[model samples]
Target: MISDTAEYALRAVVWLVQTPDESQTTRQIAEGTRTPLDYQSKVLQLLAKSGITKSQRGTGGGIRLNVSPDGLTVLDVINAVDPIQRIHSCPLGLKEHGTCLCPMHRGLNDAVKTVEAAFKNTLVADLLKTRSKSVPLGIDLPLRAPRKPKQATA
Candidate 1:
């Protein structure tokens, strides 16, 4: 199973894809994805470090997706925050077991592999095209505040 951080990262990525043209602050992303602001901030930092997203400072600056949604995979987002750890050897470190895993452990590892493959194949753009009525995170919240109209020049 994916970690909560991974789930939050996926939600954040999906939200970003929805508003591809604009950069979003951490607060905006957190509100849109319904994630905790502080936690989301950390997740975004990890993503930026991983090259999945980019951050900018100063006016009109914020975080934005670095990779195209069409090219970005679910695994890319999940791995950016919490990497899926594969069990290669016995978790108990049994001398006899060595690289061989017990039946239960092998099963668990196989499940993890299947999930990883699926995530790797799924693009962020595909999630947005889901047939289900609910959007990612079921978030209907606006990602940005309404902009004020420009005043007439004197």
Candidate 2:
């Protein structure tokens, strides 16, 4: 499973790709991606450190994507925040298991590897090209009110 930080990073990157020519403030990116402002700021900082984004201060200055969306992959964004952890040894610390994982662990690790590979192959720009009716970040959709929970009958 991906961490919230990683998810936020992905959202930030995808959002940036939407307007590659414009520089967006942390607040704007956070609001656009539905991520927390403070958390989004930290995530952007990490991304900038990783050379995935560039930040400028003062008038008309903000954060922008440093790398091209065509060249940037989903794994690149995730790794900038929290790299996918691979199982290298026994998580349970079973002396018998050691470096060789059990069947269950091996299967889980394999599944993770599959996910990692998929992400590595997926470009951030590809998310914008989806033919689905729903758009990523809902940029093209009208805002909708949150649904209220149904009240139980007495």
Candidate 3:
């Protein structure tokens, strides 16, 4: 799973993408995205430092994206916020890890690679301009009811 920090950063980026001309205060991004204010501020700060976002500090001040949404890939956002180097490292730091995958660290690298590929391929602009190709969580199915069991070992 992607870090919650990355998820919040993407939400902030999407908010900026749709409102390219408006300076969204961190508070506004937090409230709009349902993220906690402190977390939003920290994420905003990281984005600012990374030059992905520009900040205005005085009256009527806030933040805005420096790059157009189309030019901003998910990798850009990922790097700007929660970097994934540790993700690629072996959990157990084993050398000679092979396709068989060390039992002590079975499939960990593959899991990280999957996340990297997903983030690398996605773009912030694509998020703003499109409907999700798959059903979003809490949308396609009932949220509260127990899932029905497979019938009779069909």
How many clashing pairs per prediction, in order?
0, 0, 0
lDDT of each: 0.83, 0.86, 0.71
For candidate 3, list the clashing residue pairs, or say none.
none
Model 3: residues with Cα > 4 Å off, grouped in runs: 86-90, 93-106, 132-154
Clashes of 1: 0
The TM-score that candidate 1 achieves is 0.86
Expressed as tens digits, the lDDT of each residue in 1-154 for candidate 2 is 8999999998898787766666899999999999999999999999999999998999978988888777789999999999999999999999999999999999999999999999999987777766577888877532222223237899
Instruction: Return whichever of 1 and 3 wins on lDDT.
Output: 1
TM-score of each: 0.86, 0.87, 0.73
Which model scores highest in lDDT?
2
Candidate 2 clash pair list: none
In terms of lDDT, model 3 sits at 0.71
Shift of residue 122 alpha carbon in model 3, Å: 1.1
Candidate 1, residue 123: how far the Cα is off, in Å: 1.0
